[model samples]
Target: MEPNRTRLIGEYIVGPRIGSGSFAVVWRARHRQLGIEVAVKEIDKKLLSPKVSDNLLKEISILSTISHPNIIRFFEAIETREKIYLVLEYCDGGDLAAYIHKHGKVSEAVARHFMRQLGISIFTFWLFIFDQISSAGLQVLQEKHLIHRDLKPQNLLVSTNEVTPVLKIGDFGFARSLTPQDLADTLCGSPLYMAPEIIQNHKYDAKADLWSVGAILFQLVTGKPPFDGSNQLQLFQNILTSTELRFPPGAIEELHPDCVDLCRCLLRQNPVERITFKEFFNHRFLGELR
Candidate 1:
């Protein structure tokens, strides 16, 4: 029996199914009284493993506490014995992955615009966590950073606006509140956008997210990911062995030097050499936007 199909979850009437994944289905819904539209992600509890269940709770915990313009807004959660319905703000423009596929890359100006939003979203999360740790006098606990392990275009949703579409970071399934110093060793995230340390089974931290950002920025201006292979093995090999981050021949001439420089800095194979979030937020490519 599909729980939300042609039925109500609390006061919200679930309408058509809007999206889905292996364990969950997202429905377009509206409030009975206010008639306000929202997205309800219905997850089947029975389908979850212990690890996945823990991640779901972690995601809920993180979303419930954080509020930022660039992050997805969580409205409420309605849970039953069989399912969990997450009511969230509706974004009509869809995710950045679909946008990139449809538009087939964008101008450097457009890339900068999108990157600025992404930078702010990630940086704001850092500040938010920092403030909490400081307020609690837990500065010595270096494991308080919230790392969005999987930072890719697909997880970034665009909220349509009359002047400019707003990009909001979503999908906190792989996010963890641990700093780089903690050196989390979990192997997770998409192959193309994943940092090298993660792929090699090396301990990594929040800097891995910055590498994903660089990959996204690269794909944004070049129309394709920086590295590609027929299979995961080959892909990982290419990412590990590639000494230089090269731009498509004609692509470099069209972009600002700062843009290319930022990509190079962020994609450095060695995490120690990669630019930190502070530097990324202050990078010249995004400086003017700030």
Candidate 2:
């Protein structure tokens, strides 16, 4: 009744469960002949609702088509009448959220290192240089007209053992292809790092990602988010209009003023006024990029 729980889709044997969400279950798996480790996510056939299965399929389709160092490299996927199988590369370090939670906050040097790694990821994108892993990802996304709706600390995955860090973006489940319908009201993503436009149900685009980056950068510097509240309404209110999230004097003293200035430009309420990917690429904060 539970299907072949002991088996795998092809050569990968389903092992211990790694994580489970409302829509799917992730398991640590191994390839029989290749002897390679992999993460297998299976969509529950019974609970397939709200077209989640379709979403999983779409994610697989896109991931399969695109190849970037920063993007999660898709291993393989299988579909049957009863279920769907997605085999992904295993990241030993896990998500960035776990790392941040373990260590109160990341250091300024480490934050820049992460950004550099992310830049390298977009290197292979259409408009970016292929075979390079240190180019800015935001620039590539802008060229492709794609907006990463969910950009948070947790979504980043680090893969190196160095003190600075080498990172990549993961989890495309909440991603959506921009369309005419997207020009309307629909607010999605975690609240802690959400932008004012998203909080007010206003039309948003790629600029929403800049706001999220600000929140992540804030947490990296202050060890906490810009706003904190026990309830949803209060949190939403703070994110929508509270400008008190500015950097504490003590915190800014530890880093260059340009870093703080860049955060402000990116987090600006008017999406039109927010920092552009090209501008960010040329900002003094990214001195090396310029």
Candidate 3:
């Protein structure tokens, strides 16, 4: 599809297309008067169902409230008769998924740095087991009971700095709010990162986010996901029944032992057995890093 180059969105001048998804198209834009670069997400209301539109709106609303150094910043929202434009901070370094692809098996020290930062930014870190990942500015969202259902490397944006890039959690398209007692039934998120409870179609809460975090941490250290299969059916089967996680050979000896322990606790099959946020924060794995 040919993109329109002559169009101006609000006070911003659209540049090249940076990203495209089923619900929206993101463009690199420069503020007309301020001369600052920002990302503009354009969503066509006509193409989305009412439910989908509501989700998108919720994402914008959630972003509006969250302001963390490790979370994407929302500038403004512009609406038209048939479309919605969301202005957000642009991360020139792209996402963690791309970074991992380019540089396999990040050093343990680097991973610890990123994980510690993410751990601190989390708000309302405990709820029967739900712990949202990243950003001191994200507390308001947790107080409101919102959860980022899809927590993966692709959704984690990286700042431009190569030496020590700051990872900002972005893309709240699948984010949703649920009360402490409520369990989310929707089986959403990437197949590779799906928590065991999710694959079983069992009711899940924000605790599911922790499982995803574990998967991401594992992949960052090992250069691959904990589980693998030839097809979706097999993958689902493995996730549902595989209770034990097998790390790469010599991984424990090669990396910090505490790091391995944290992954095991986070990846526990039983939701009740998973590490609580309080325990996680105080654990030697992260505490020692300080």
lDDT: which candidate is best?
A: 1
lDDT of each: 0.82, 0.71, 0.81
Candidate 2 accuracy as lDDT: 0.71
List model 2 lDDT by residue over 59-87, tens digit each.
Answer: 77667766666676789887788777788
TM-scores, all models, native as reference: 0.89, 0.86, 0.89
Report the error of model 3 at residue 112, Å: 1.0
Residue 239 shift from truth in candidate 1, angstroms: 0.3
Give the TM-score comparing model 2 with the true structure, all chains together: 0.86
Q: Give the true-structure RMSD of model 1.
A: 4.9
Worst 10 residues of 3 by lDDT: 132-141
Residue pairs whose backbone atoms clash in candidate 1: none
lDDT of 1 at 66: 67
Q: Per-residue alpha-carbon lDDT of model 1 for 178-268, expressed as tens digits?
A: 8455888999999999999999999997888889999999999899999999999999999999999988889889888999999999999
**Per-residue lDDT of 11 in model 1:** 94
lDDT of 3 by residue, 69-99 (tens): 8789999999999999999999998888888
| Clash count for each candidate, listed in order shown | 0, 5, 2
Ranking by TM-score: 3, 1, 2
The parts of candidate 2 lying over 4 Å away from their true place are: 1-6, 119-134, 160-162, 179-184
